[model samples]
Target: MAALTIFWDDLSVETALDFCEYLVRSEDYKLRDLAIWIQGSGGPIDELDGSIGSLVALWSWFKSFREQGLPGVPLGARAAYSVITGRPLDSPLEEGSRLVGESVAHYVFKVILSLDPTAHWAVRAKSGRIAHAWDNTPGISMDGGKHFGPAVGFFTNYPDRLSSNYHNAYAAREAWDDTGLLQSVELLYLAGLPSRPRSTSTTESILSPLLRDDHVGSGHREEIPIAQEMPASITNNGPVSAGAEELIFASVGADVSRLDQAAPLDELAVASVLAELGFVSADGQSVSAVTLLSHGVQVQNVDGFALVETHVAGGRLRGLFLEPMRPSEKEWKSITDAFSALGEKLPAHLANER
Candidate 1:
């Protein structure tokens, strides 16, 4: 095959670096605010914490360019920066921002594609949302081939790759330019830099001596908050690890309300209740009680927490799955004890086998 032509290859590295500095300097807090907004709204993507962590790492990487100069940045990152900066200025802000976001998605596309691209599709296939959507809804196309086209044909023929959770987020967009999440995040990453340059120049430019330094005035830089003083919650960017007791209580909270329902609770009803609690079957649909008891169900997004039914001396028991680490055996026992406290013991005969 002929060598592929990268459109942004011709853009000067200095210009791209300036753009990166500008974005980081101008956009960081707004990005955090957007992340908080998404978390508060319970948006489709559950990786806000992960995204924040990535942003933090990216900030450190960008800062390294100052001490090490241009050689410090990876070639891929340089290309990525050029790609982001080369986006057409005349395009709609939403469209431009989305393109910029995709360029910086080293966290997802680059990492996945670097590992056998074809096999990564299997990972997406196994995703709860993608698998559920694929299995149940045959008509709605998950293929990005038409929408994303050939622009991102690196991993596969453009548009051939299935839509990621990031793509699905657009289906439920509430705010205008919800697609700009990545752009805001990129700005937030830049926001971590020092407010004013150490030099005599009034403008704050990244990497001491690069091109024109007048773009970001000292006054403008002063307006951006110092990243260090931000709240721990914003900086940490991970879900608060709820205690096992709290997790179990929240997980089973619906069971109490279901007691008054007309029909007796069966395995399927139990599965639906678990589904409401954010547990899903292997195929990502509403889990069945049989599956929960037999195979166990997975909790989406947040790490840890699985539903398992066990045969104990008293009877068949259902509770959160635990291991030696993570929640530890003691933490798992705490969940089980909490369940027992709730009086949820079931007879062995009620336990369904696969």
Candidate 2:
């Protein structure tokens, strides 16, 4: 009753990301073997049995893994995060952990860029949604939840992973089956091919609903009646190692009077206030109510904060939202303070001596 030994090393928790990178680079030689193992072994990795018939098919799988973030990724990403940062994937990821995550993502992006300059068709087709969400241009409305890039998603998590079966499958096999060849092939796949930008329509379809009036709290939808008091904060920045930056955009709604005490700040007034706060209109023009309604006035500062001033329910509700793209703690606090100051200066809070 000796423990069984396997020929190929199983993609384990510690090596998941590295193994995926191996798989991607060495698909020609390794993927076929993996397919054989999955098909013949009748084991847990079989969910992907018919999926890896060719390199193109494999790329599609990677594409889905990146875009959808299949279930098994969190633990794998957690494991990778620990290995990369030398820290446990604990809750309340501090600034150091956040930067490590960004560094990993930036490295992955650099890897994708280093690819062979010719992208696979599947990669090209899926390129529209590949950019990090935080890379959005000011004034443009697009999905901010898309943190996955071509190969970065694989680093975050491995997919179709069944825990027990992986251990059993590896123990059952008995050959040395080195991954040297696979590693070379994976390197070629990742570094040899670069993606081309896709059509604008593909991007438009994925725009954020938060920026779309027709989607939520719109005329047809039940209005989220303006609250009498502003909530201290509403943030989606969770503890996940990666994708946190993209989630940095926080929506805070408040009721404050204008500093002028003349009228509530309109889009133009908002733009002017933003200018004072060091944010420039995305298009270098005064924002009109029509433009604000269409695409919230996207103002970006050199300091990594983006603000989108929006009104919902046909102007009955005003919003003060902050989208910080990789801000330091001090920068975040500064941005929030600016928001508070902006709130006090607009309309009712301003005291006027008449």
lDDT of each model, Cα atoms only? 0.30, 0.33
| Residue lDDT tens for model 2, 1-354 | 111111112122333334234324432322233233223333233222221122232333433433343322233343222333244334422222222232223323323323322322121111221222223211101132222232333331222221232345344433322232123234223332323422212222111222333543323311112223212232234222222232111122322332122223455555555566566445544444455444244556644334444433344324434555544455555556665565565542221112
lDDT score at residue 130, model 2, on the 0-100 scale: 21
Cα shift from native, residue 234, model 2 (Å): 22
Q: Estimate each model's TM-score.
A: 0.25, 0.35
The TM-score between candidate 2 and the true structure equals: 0.35
- State the lDDT of candidate 1 residue by residue for 1-354, as single tens digits: 121222222223343334334444534333332333233333322332232333333323322322243231232332232234343333232232333233333233222222222211111111244222122110101133211112222211112112242334344644423233333333221322222312222222121221224533333421312222222221123332343332322123334222222123244444454454445544555555555444234433122243433221122223333321124344345444543443353311111111
Full-model lDDT, candidate 1: 0.30
Task: Estimate candidate 2's alpha-carbon lDDT, on a 0 to 1 scale.
Answer: 0.33
